[model samples]
Target: MRTLTLVRRVAPLILLLVVLAVLTVRAAEQLDNQDTYFHLRFGHELLGEWSLRDPGSVSSFATADWVPTQWLPQITMAAVEDRAGLAGVAWLSGLAFLALALTLYVVARRRVEPLAAAPLTALALVASSSGLSARPQVLSYLLVAVTATAWLAAARSGRTPWWLVPLTWVWACCHGMWPVGLAIGGVAVLATALRPDRRWDRVARGAAVVALSGLATLVTPVGPRLLGAVVAVDERREFFSEWGRPDPGDPRLLALLALLLVAAAALAWRGTDGPRGPRTLRGLRESPDLTALGLLVLAGGCTVASGRTVPVAAALLVPVAATALHRHLGDRPAWTRLEQVVVLGGVALALPVLAAVVPHTADEPPARPAWTDPALAALPAGTPVLNDWNLGGWLMWRHPQLDPVMHGYGDTFTVEELRRNTDILALRPGWRTLVRETGVSYALVRPRSPLGRALVDDEGWRVLHRSPDLVLLKPPPGWM
Candidate 1:
């Protein structure tokens, strides 16, 4: 009995420490995501300029008036990068990911035993892994986890979460997903109304909380204009792969699918009464808290909506799934204070470990070579370079002096510019003319791309540098 008791006491700390170690190592493995480049550069520019409007100077092809919706985290990242370089940014990312894991576990442990809560939390992390990059979106994910937990608690306690208003304000400044939190609040209000002991006063107060949260978003630096920025991105979703449909074969999606299935099975089993089972569908309907059911439905919708929302769905599902699985284990004692301290304290030590490792491991961008810096610096400022979409952010950050014709920021380009950039890169019928019109004499792109092949084979551009991954080519003399 003593051995079993000791094992239970030590397990939670072990679980969190293992998670911290895994996430820290993963986050420290080189900075390669294309958007991370532009975010850091933009953050630095915002620090210097103190503005939310893009200068429209980062790329020569940007025709849209871009609003920087994700300024707060960008500025924070820029400050960290300035003081400690990219390693600091990696350490910061490790901290954000650790916070996310701890938040999920703490919330789950409130209603579920530690053993049950731990696995459910792990499943949610795996489901959310695809969206866990070192970007402002990570902040949004953390806020989503908080929002879901607060609303779920309020659903049972019959109290409104007034604190969510200020959180929404901070979330708006950090990322464009503040509205999602408000939507969950709205759902919670409806769930409160559906309870068997529903109180009209509680329902009204819940609605007020959601209203105030929405209003809070309007007060951020971008103010009412923030809504327009979010809508603009949605209108141009075709150009962004993140906005595409969730792939059925993605392992993250598979994890989420398994989680949803398990939660549903648990709910179904709970409604049964031995061999007789639930007398009617009505029993099943009233079996679980309406708030949990509503959140699960929301998770399902997010899962089907697009690839970008999978993490949101996973966040929404964790608290409900943990509690649902706990129903099978019967009632258990809540975590002791010492147990909480051990788990949290161990997670905290990850920061120092990450600080030591990241500086060495995450010093360079993955796609950039040792020779890239000197080669690009040789070109004069304002020299137009033909580059594919993937290379645009790197050039924008490392060599803002040279203008690139296309980049990954979809909302910054007009519809015509986006389609034209695609056509040129794909080597469509008018690609040659489009390339010439840009006045680009230098090309930095994949050697195997259609544009690269056309420039070398048909236009006879000379290879200035060659690598298996990328090639630098110069147009024939007098061609520009």
Candidate 2:
């Protein structure tokens, strides 16, 4: 009784600590990336005018593009900035992450022993933290958690919540990953609809929920244009790095994926044809919902196998894993309490060790001044500057007056535009033509890159700024 009591009390705290550790590590490593700048700019733009469209923009690079997917988060960030500036944004992000962690704990508590939920929550936090940034991805993560909790609750009680569908509609406007939420909901509906022995009424209700959620996704600020853009981007996986197939060589991702797969297989084997396991599996065989959970597990594993899908894997796995652990463990055994205490104590003891291993300082140079060229600096305010992908975020944040030719707006640029720009930088002919056609008055290049060296050596362009890791160049006099 004492052991069970201790496990119940400490599990939530362990989960919270693990989440904080993950978020802290992520914050330390990923503070000043290009995507951060894009979101920051979006926040500034929205706060200034409550519009997604950029005003006073000179770049031919689709200034009117409405990034409705990231709009709500941007609006929220704008509000944070109004209250506390950039520091507030960071705090807000941290709080948002904390909220997500709490939701994970709640979901876990419902499905698994509170003590067992700690490790699952920790794993989910670590996996999701990889993709955690001040971008639309964060919003997607939160929405996924919210959707999962609702679905799980609805599944347990036969009555699907009416509010979840409309919430998804709002979510659709807030992030491009709305499709993921819809997919999860579809799985739930299919599970309900396909349950052979279950009453058709329950299945019908699930199907209706799924249909409404799908329809809700269309009611965004840009309406069908949002869907069109999403479809276009989805169809162009070859053009984007994150959209591409996952590389098998990444050790961290691979290891976690392997562990998850092993756990899943172990659970399946233990549940199948094993007299020692819980009764849940006996009933699960006929329930489409359980089968859907298994599919979700598989989907999450595939996502984790590819670095691009890490966030998706994190979002989908937590609840499913908790549910599985819950069904398997049922009531905690008396001896399990000692194991729980040991695990919690070990996690506590290792906190300092983990902290020491993770970098504490942001040693990376200030992205704006470090990358901006003197020529671009001398140009009139609002000059359109072409910048590298990594530097675009910082430029957007520091130089809101200047409209960048391109930034980290992943959905804003067409696949053709991305291909053209990428090809130009990779090949000499494309590079030169891009410089000429874009009327790029300034170019921000990473100093270590071959393109930066080429620009410095070429007489056609002048190096206007230099830093340890960045270089700025300008077109020759009389050329744009």
Choose the strongest candidate by lDDT: 1
What's each prediction's clash count? 0, 3
Alpha-carbon runs more than 4 Å astray in model 1? 1-13, 53-56, 275-286, 330-332, 477-480
Residue-level lDDT of model 2, residues 142-219, one tens digit each, is 677667767766666888767878888887777777777777776776666666666688777777777888777676
Whole-model Cα lDDT of every candidate shown, in order: 0.81, 0.63
Q: What is the lDDT of candidate 1?
A: 0.81
How many collisions between residues are there in candidate 1? Answer: 0
Task: Spell out the clash pairs found in candidate 2.
Answer: 37-393, 69-174, 69-175
lDDT (10s digit) by residue, model 1, range 414-439: 87888889899878898888888888
